[model samples]
Target: MIVDHRIYTCHPGKLAAFVKLYEEAAWPLQQKYLKNCLGWFTTTEGELNTVVHLWGYDSLADRDAKRGAMAADPAWGEYLAKSASMGLLQKQENRICKPAPHYEAYTKAKG
Candidate 1:
């Protein structure tokens, strides 16, 4: 399986608001399309205004299809517009990860 790990950096003191927006707007949409979110996180010490989200997919094709569905949704478009208008996001970094052999996530995918 592959993990779509995303890191979103928000403007100073805007992380809470950004998270709230996601909760109110995008969270349900994600559940409908990308059903396997491993975790959503906010840092305590190292990175101050960043949110990390991990999504698990069976393969790249799975990720692509799910993300395409989400991207096509009108609700998703609305959320993006809201976020852009608010200027809550500063940067976005994404990493597509493959679990190494013997890892729990990898093993589960095999099973």
Candidate 2:
């Protein structure tokens, strides 16, 4: 599986608002278009106002298609606008990753 990780640094004091909008508005829209969307979460420790979410895809093509589908959805567009209006995030970073051979071992050890 492929994992698309998005790291968002929100403006100070806006983390709660961002999370509310993400859960109430954006996540539902994402659910409609992205069947492989694993989940969305935020960092509570090291980076205080950082959001990290992951989407799982069968392949690169599947990811592209799902994103396109989401973009085309009217509800998703509305949700995006609403979510964006909630707060201005300071920085955004996106990374696409595949599980490495040692990933399982690392996760097991961490667990």
* Candidate 1 ranges beyond 4 A from true positions: 104-111
lDDT of 1 by residue, 40-96 (tens): 999898989999999999999999999999999999999999999999999999999
Candidate 1: C-alpha lDDT: 0.95
| Tens digit of per-residue lDDT, candidate 2, span 14-69 | 88988887788778878888866676777878988999888998888999999998
Considering only N, C-alpha and C atoms within 3 Å, which residue pairs clash in candidate 2? none
How many clashes (backbone N, Cα, C below 3 Å) per candidate?
Answer: 0, 0
* Model 2 lDDT-worst window of ten: 79-88
